[model samples]
Target: MDEERPPVVLVPRGGAWGEAVAAAARQRGLDPVVVPLIADAPPEDPAALDAALARLAAGHEDSAEDADEDGVPDGRHGAPPTGRTRPDAAGPGAPWLVVTSATAVRVVAGRVPRLPAGVRVACVGAATARAARQAGWPVDLVPDDESAAGVAAALPSDAGPVLFPRSEIAATTLVDGLRARGIAVSEVVAYRTVGTGDEPVVLAPPPDAVLVTSGSVAQQVVRRMTPLDPRTHVACIGPSTADAARAAGLPVHVVARSRSAEALLDAVVETLHPNPRTGRSS
Candidate 1:
């Protein structure tokens, strides 16, 4: 008789993201049990966000120029004297819209039907970039690193004032980095992360592994689901989240190489099944 496969507990954000993780778990030969740890809702006060969006739109209207037939800047149509194209098409005055998460993109799109023209959109990772593109915004930059610090470093020195819309519990990484570089930053609380207040449902058989995707999720797990089994593996999505898990007294067994769902799943797989000969995941 075949041995029963151990189940993997996934603490994911509800909706499409959660469904995707369930599908990925099946492909990896792990039985998935979803326990949504946190939920997001728009911020209570919309006045500040509304005002910021208005200012950004107004700035664009005041400075934007018409693109040529080829969709290039009018004056700089051909290659320059050095045979190189200009780095940025938006003028220095255009506001830089930096989105670090898909949730942030959704919140911003709900308030502003269309993004202001000429505003440059920068995302922290491929997932956030896809969200912005789907919402009819053109992405200008995606840093090689998925963290806030990485995004800050990738931005041009002369990029204009940044408008960052994020969750209320967001870390200070981006804000601090941008301000240190002398760039003006205006932060809008786009959403709030709230706990469900319901206790986590106990699995018939405890999970073999538990995945932590965010710092808020880590906090909720520690608060709601205390006394985790020692044998269960705790996997984090990245370094910052791993730090949160450790701070909450969770024993982290794996950390993803990148901030993508695929990389995170890879970490879980390696933690659960190391290669026999090399004693490392293949």
Candidate 2:
């Protein structure tokens, strides 16, 4: 009998997202070891976040009342107390709630269970959009590019104020891009990405590939697991993350076509198994 192969992939992430990646790896016939390099925590200052949620909730309530008085039946529930806010008076149009990560979805859903009626939600990628839908929040837009600029491009030019809940160290691409387009945006730090200090354990045989999901994770991988072996492939989730890996002097073997768990796994498999016909990995 052949000796069982050692785990081939190392997932340096945490929580549900990490689990999802590991599971996908298993489906692809690769054993995965999860060693989270970073953890997410609520923002140090949640006052601003709370205040913004409150304002949105209040605005929703006002709109719900107006809709009732005008004999307009609530679409979700046709009744006097719609139990939902109306979107028309919120701004020039429904305020766009842009969520860039699953963490943002958790933060917003936990704080405000019910969003104001007519609030449009734009997610950065398919993963973030799925999280929003799972949290019972309707998603209006998901960009094909799966990046900050993608979210901005997907939004309407005359869109109302955008509420962006993101990580503390999030890049200004989306926020800056929207503002340059003459759109008012209120950005709040919903969470902070902090190092867990739990370094990846050195196995008898090192993992064949190490997954880097974010720029922060890339920094931690460099700090904790420096001097990585040349053979160890560094697979990044997207271009931004690949740039971070390159900036840290880590060799990037592959980058996912999209910023989803499945895509990440596909990138890894393609790197390990190049297609003979095209001389390229999927």
Candidate 3:
């Protein structure tokens, strides 16, 4: 009998996102091994994050305090969020909370459940939006293009200052882009990325495909699992990650059209099967 196909593994660390990736791989008949190459760590200095969150929480409370007995908020509820604090606003001035990743949504929501009145939310993509919704946040903006540049381009230039909570190694694309547009962005480190520090992974049957989700994960993969089989396909979630993989001296087999697990797996499936209706090549 022919040898069984090797399993695929990905992400290194994604939490909920990782689970979604694994499920997608399974649907494609790619049993992926989940070996977290890195883990989430609290920032060494969380004072900045704490302060920002406190202000947001206060604003959330103040907004609630404005509601009448009929539950009609005297704030931006029935009305659209102006992205600026109204003179009679119940809460403190609100800022636009920008989230680019599902992880960011999880982290921020853990602190502030629902956003304060007048504080609009902008997520980069559908997955992140879903996460924010699950966390009880009202996502006000999701760019048609699901990338950092996309978010920066989509946000209104005349809007209020933006409160951006992100990972330690987050790229400067959004911040830089917004800044160049003369928009005020207050970036806070919500979490840190630390190596899981486990010894190099050893697999009897190496993964046929590897999913690279983030730049950090790409680095870890290179460090822990170098000397990959030439036949092993490396799939990146987006162009930025593909750039990182190439920088790390790892050959990238494919870059997903969009930034999602299903997209990544779809690209891999396409590579694996040239024929759409049939698994075999046409």
TM-score winner: 1
TM-score of each: 0.85, 0.83, 0.82
Ranking by lDDT: 2, 1, 3
lDDT by residue (1-282, candidate 2, tens digit) is 112463378898878878888888877766689988889898999999998777666544544554445444333221233334334332223457899988899989998887776677899999899999999988878888899998888786645557898899999999998988777788888999999886556644667789888899889888888778666789999999999889987889989999987898888877776334432322
Q: Which of the predicted structures, 2 or 3, would earn the higher TM-score when compared with the native?
A: 2
User: Cα deviation in Å at residue 60, candidate 1?
Assistant: 1.9
What tens digits encode model 1's per-residue C-alpha lDDT throughout 213-259? 88888888788776777767788988888999999888899899988
Q: Which candidate, 1 or 2, has the higher TM-score? A: 1
Per-structure clash totals for the candidates: 0, 2, 1
CA lDDT of each candidate? 0.76, 0.77, 0.75
For model 3, state the Cα shift of residue 60 in Å: 8.0
Off by over 4 Å in 2: 1-7, 59-92, 198-201, 274-282
Distance from true location, Cα of 259 in model 2, Å: 0.9
Cα-based RMSD of the predictions, in order? 5.1, 6.5, 5.3
